[model samples]
Target: MATGRSTVFEDRSHAGAALGMKLSTLLPAGEYTVLGLLRGGVPIAHEVAKTLGATLGAVAVRKLGVPSNPELAFGAIAQYGPDSARHINEAIYRRALQYFGKDELESLERGTGADLLALADTFKAYCPELAGRDLLLCDDGMATGATMKAALDLVQGLAPASIRLAVPVASPETAAGLAPQVNGICQLLTPDNFTAVGAFYEDFGQVGQDQVLEMLRATQ
Candidate 1:
């Protein structure tokens, strides 16, 4: 019952660490796996995995946007498992492509589908299988979730006993949308008027590939 001033949620890593502390108290005695949506998610997930004595792996997802308007996301694609890839596209990629130059469009086509398939293969080959397992999916924070929605859809194919989406903070709308798709959600803060993920965090720094690899190495 450490409920009081949660102002420390302002720090992304601190917020995530706090969330890990909270979840360790709440989860029941059972088997569970922690899967982080890298590369932003890896550090946060490492703590949870260590606390749970659970296996860890990456869930790679990419946002598909128009080549011209890379800022605008149309949908999300993810590498779920050895044989599962899923996409959730509320906005048509074609429309987003209008914003991109031809070169960027070709780049998108080249790097979209097959890359995710390879990523899924890597997740399955490198990490433990998640079938019928109680799984916890961790991330740095939530944006529109077009990318995460696709990742969760793919995780569903693994036939996990449950999928819990955990974040330190998120917008109420995003948390509400993901509620049905996930078995449960662990969000410490949910404000009605959310502008961006960074606004909630004090030190919203970049989590790059080097940081993720270092965390993985340390955990191993």
Candidate 2:
């Protein structure tokens, strides 16, 4: 069952811990895996992993942002093992690209090479033991959900028994959009006036590469 309600969180850690408590009471006792979407998702997943006593891993997804506003995403790419998948909002992508001229658009596409490679490396490093286990796909929050959508697509290819999306906060519309795709959902907050994911967090700092690697290493 997909359940959601509005709630406030102190920080990523607090939200993770609170969500973990709720999940503990809801999920049946069994072997489960906790896979956090890389960057911001890692911190929240760390707490969930600890609370649930599940192995932790990372799902690398890079959003293809609007050239002018990097925070707004029109598409995203997710990589795992040797495979990569992309999800694009063509309506937004077409409109957003108009801001950049031909030369700039070409340059932007070329710049994606390094990021795509890094996403592949991160996926290979963090993903293993994914088959035949109940999985929790987590993030700190979701706005447009393009990246998380990509993450979900990648994980589905791995043949997990079940996949549930767990996020600290998400807009009601985004939560509803994701509900039918996954087996279950655990969104602590579903604000109607959602502007961005960071707006709901007190300490939504960037998660560095070193921190992500260290968090994954600790689970192994």
Candidate 3:
């Protein structure tokens, strides 16, 4: 059931705390890691990692959008690992390369070797070695799930035993679409009238790279 209307949570941290409390139940106790999408997913993932006693890291994902409308994301770019940095479909990326500058495009292709890189740096920092571990993918919410999907698809190659999608709130339709991609979906609130993901948060500010790094540092 959903409200079909937007409502704000206390803040990104509290929103994450609510979601993390629920995600902790699904995970088995072990040496696992929680990877958050940059800028938005970091705070939420940090709270979850704290609750589950897991390592906090970042996963890099870039939204593929229509050439004219860069904001409309059609898909995402998932990096291979922290240092692994492998991504699929270089051809498609080449098609979209014009949308970004050389360094920006290369950073996406290489995955972790960019400086002052805004969001992608998250994955490079936390899960540099992406193989042979349990990964819980956390984000604030999903509007279309395309970006999250791309991340999951790319991560599939690195071979995590289990991948989970955890969030505080999301569109019911989007959550349903992602159900098959991951091992489990633990979300607290689903709004039927889903628009932008930020609508559900009062303090929906951008999650900065340094902030994400700090969250990762705290867990370490």
Candidate 4:
């Protein structure tokens, strides 16, 4: 838990370093694969992979947000290897169906699935084999946690020996909800009054795809 209303980190790298150090103490000694959610998570996972001496990889995930409000996610999708998974928020999805025809919603989901596949294709070379390996999933932070849940579903299908989640900050509710689903969780901050993931960082700029590719390349 963080005290005061001050920001928790200078930037993503700084946050990643802090998170990596914390994870180092929590995770046992073993071969681990660090998979960062694409874009923002790549840089954070880069630092964590360095700290843990683990192979770095990226997971491409996309939120299926409502067409009217792109920020409000009704579901999410994630991909690893040739496998993919989706998680739909049942409550939200039910509400969405009230205002949207089944065909419209299916079309939206298919389009997002195509986008996820494209990203997976672009990142295929950097992904590592998951079976019988310990996995540490990294992300910049978790707000609603829909995408992280989707990522977890995708990876669990691959039969890893274990799975843990690491993040710099998350809301208390989100952290608690996800705790039971992972072997362990490493979180630097879980503010009770959390508004958004960006609020805890001084430099929470949008991460571009080029930056993600460069980070993945450096890890190779």
Candidate 4, residues 173-215, lDDT tens digits: the string is 8889999999988899988788888888999998988888888
Score every model by TM-score.
0.81, 0.89, 0.78, 0.95
Best lDDT among the predictions, by candidate number: 4
Q: Candidate 2 lDDT, tens digit per residue, 1-220?
A: 2233333566778888988988899898987899888878887888889889998988777887778887788778887777667788777787876767657755665566468777668557777678899999999998999899988888888889999999988878889999999999998777777877877767777878888788778888
The TM-score ranking, best first, is 4, 2, 1, 3
Indicate the TM-score of model 2. Answer: 0.89
Consecutive 10-residue window with the lowest summed lDDT within model 3: 80-89
Clashing pairs in 2: none
Report the C-alpha displacement of residue 191, candidate 2, in angstroms: 0.5
Report RMSD (Å) for each prediction in the order shown: 3.8, 3.0, 4.7, 1.4
Candidate 3, residues 1-220: lDDT per residue as tens digits?
Answer: 4666565677779988887787666667777778887657889888988888787877766665545565555345555443223323455556666667656655543443342144444345466455778888888888777667776776777878788888888778879978987888888778766778878777887666677778888877
Candidate 1 structure quality by residue, lDDT tens digits, 1-220: 1122334455556776788887888887788888788567777788778777778778877676665555456676776555445564535655555656557755775587767666555445335588889999888777777767777888888788989988876767788888988778887767666666677667777777666666666666
Q: Whole-model Cα lDDT per candidate?
A: 0.71, 0.81, 0.71, 0.89
Which parts of model 4 have CA positions greater than 4 angstroms off? 2-6
Ranking of all predicted structures according to lDDT, beginning with the best and ending with the worst: 4, 2, 1, 3
